[model samples]
Target: MYSRSFNIKKDLAMRNEFAKKALDANPSHPQTNYDYGLALCNEKKFDEALIYINKAIDMDPANKDRFEGFLPLLFMAMRDTENSLKWLLKMSERDSHSRYLGWLSCVYAHIDDLDKASDYLKRFLDERPEIKTLSDYRKVAPAIAKNL
Candidate 1:
């Protein structure tokens, strides 16, 4: 367990370094900013991560909806359910993907809104027949699943 945790930290540090170098080389690049933001998120630096992530979204407004999907989970990790719900609700309305339904369910569950959570969870499962169990859901979204 200790070794696994240490290796995870080391990997995140390496990721942050590489992403920082890439962002420095091309600060205007949307993908580079997004990648560095993701690295910061992996390190649990939520505020700094948002700055880069939002910058990336602003740089490429055409793909804003797609780019913003990660925000709900990031906010969930920060224990900011209000923001998480805000993004999840936004994505649920805009995104065609089924995962947002699952995320919505997870956030609802986290907030003790079981009726809404179950409704979203059912919708998610209906869309994704392959995800038949909590274990299967965890495989696809461990962070969100853990809340359930």
Candidate 2:
């Protein structure tokens, strides 16, 4: 576990440095902005991550789907449930995948919107019936399942 943690940190440091260089070379490039934003998120720099992620979304509106997931995650990391729910709802509108439904359930549960949470959770379960247990649900949304 210690070695795994150390390796993850080392890998993220390397990726962060590479992303920084890429962003410096092309500050307005959408892909560079997205990569740098993701690297910043891995570094736990949520504010900086959101800036670049939003920039990426603005520069490439047609590819907004690519950047949507990061926004909610950064907001969640910052404990800003309103923004998280905003982005997650946008993501859900864009994609009806079980993964997004699961995220919606988790975020709604975070904000104590149990009705929405349960609705999304039911949708998620309907789409992912292979998930057979509470432990399986925990794998998707640990904190939310704990509340349920």
Candidate 3:
């Protein structure tokens, strides 16, 4: 986990260096665009982040995880329910067994859809029943912080 965080940090730094070079030469490169968007997402600059994320997606939507993860979460953080739900459905279809169900629990909670939240919460808990209360949830759950 430490290595993954280190790599994310390292990747961000390397990408920033590369971004400077790209900016000096031409900012139109797809990788530069994507990396800039990824960096912006890491920085929590969602609106600016989305511009480049969409640019990268338009250039090549084949890497669906980029759009689905980075873009949708940006919208979610911004409280843009429309786009968030749209991507949530798409992501759920792509990988229902994934940890994203934990996110779904939060979304449903946010919308005051406790019933659905409870359903997904049950699934999430059932997936790893060891997590029962908020205290235990802090540790027993996966490394990624997602609502259950």
Candidate 4:
């Protein structure tokens, strides 16, 4: 509720406060940990967010796909392309959705591996040709918007 409300109102401070309180009450709770981690990430505290998010994934391995999706984005936000690629590769091993392929293309582009980038991009386009506009590309893969 707090997270949703924060998203609606764009209230960072309030969201951070609520997330912190939730974490304080149940430090090991997966959802709370993930929420707090998300809030920290919004604050650009990537390292701190990574700690909580990793804990959340560890506490609830069954929901690893959810948590793992964030890992690559976090690394990308930190401009750590190598780490981003590493997490993206891990995610691809577990899931092969078209969205993942699009991200893989972006990450490959970031590393100047245009061959791999073009390959993944081609696959992604073949899978999701509806994605056309710059806005659409930005919405789906902001990291690769330039490449698109």
Candidate 5:
């Protein structure tokens, strides 16, 4: 009997391998490429990671989620705040709550940009009210909290 496995680490590895095989079989599946990049980012291979992530975006630049959210979010995790901000700035004009604002808040705070950090944190709180009352930010940025 074959049972389904629900391990994220295993799934992530499977996704990476499946992505590689899928790309080899059909060189234009953007979703597979994007999944690969996400896995690579999760594995902490940011530099080599960008190659696959860029391929996905280049294939479909209209997919703002790739460029504006996932890719830049990974960059922010890698502490590439400059590039992170660049991509985040490209998304600033959009309506609705801000996703990158949280990254900005943390980076700006790290860099002594108190005014901007404070501003971003407020915006982040507005966008996610539940986050305001929480005693832990680590529910999201666990690696960062480990260092702090």
Candidate 6:
């Protein structure tokens, strides 16, 4: 709800405070930790966010698939292109049919690896021919298109 508010900053701050309180009250709860970590991520506190997020993942390894794809985006948000690429690669290895080929291209583009980016883009297009332009890319992966 706060994420879609008119006063986004204020709402996000309020949401973060509430999430922090919940986290403090339930330190071992995976959902609480995940919510707090997500709030911190929204505030751009990447390093701190990582601790809680990783803890939540550790506590719930059975659901790791729910976050594996998103971890690369989080690393990208932290401007850790290497880690982003590594995570994306790991995700691809884990699930070849996953919708990350385009994300791979975007990450490569961010690192100025146009050749790899083009190759990945071609692969992505082969899988998703409907995404033919920048607008389509933005709709699917805006964060990945940040560098582009």
TM-score versus the correct structure, for each prediction: 0.80, 0.79, 0.72, 0.86, 0.74, 0.80
Candidate 4, run of 10 with poorest lDDT:
139-148
> Candidate 5's residue-wise lDDT over 51-106, tens digit each?
87788788888884745456556666677778877766665646344656776787
Best by TM-score: 4
Model 3 alpha-carbon miss at residue 75, Å: 1.5
**For residues 1-148, what per-residue lDDT tens digits would candidate 6 score against the true structure?**
2333423555777788778888888899887787788788767898998888888899889987775656887888888889989999999988876267888887888789999999998999999888889787777774433653
TM-score of 6: 0.80
Query: Model 1: what TM-score?
Result: 0.80
Candidate 4 local Cα displacement, residue 133, angstroms: 4.0
lDDT of 4 by residue, 1-148 (tens): 4664785688888888889998898887998998898899767898999999999999999997897788888887877889988998998888888878988987888789999999999999899989976578777664423332
Off by over 4 Å in 2: 1-10, 138-148
lDDT of each: 0.80, 0.77, 0.66, 0.83, 0.65, 0.78
List candidate 3 stretches off by more than 4 Å: 1-26, 135-148
Off by over 4 Å in 4: 142-148
Candidate 1 segments whose C-alpha is farther than 4 A from its true place:
1-10, 142-148
User: Candidate 1 residues 1-148, lDDT tens each?
Assistant: 1223434566766677778888888899888888788778767798898899999999999988767978888788778889989988888788668988888887788789999999998999899999988778778884533652
- Residue 108's lDDT within candidate 2 is 82
Better of 4 and 6 by TM-score: 4
After TM-score superposition, what is the CA distance of residue 30 in candidate 2 from its true location, in Å?
1.3
Q: How many collisions per candidate?
A: 0, 0, 0, 0, 0, 0
Q: After superposition, how far is residue 75 of candidate 2 from its true place, in Å?
A: 1.5
Best by lDDT: 4
**Model 2 Cα lDDT, one tens digit per residue, 48-133:** 88889889999999998877766766777877889878987888787777877887887888779999999998998899998888
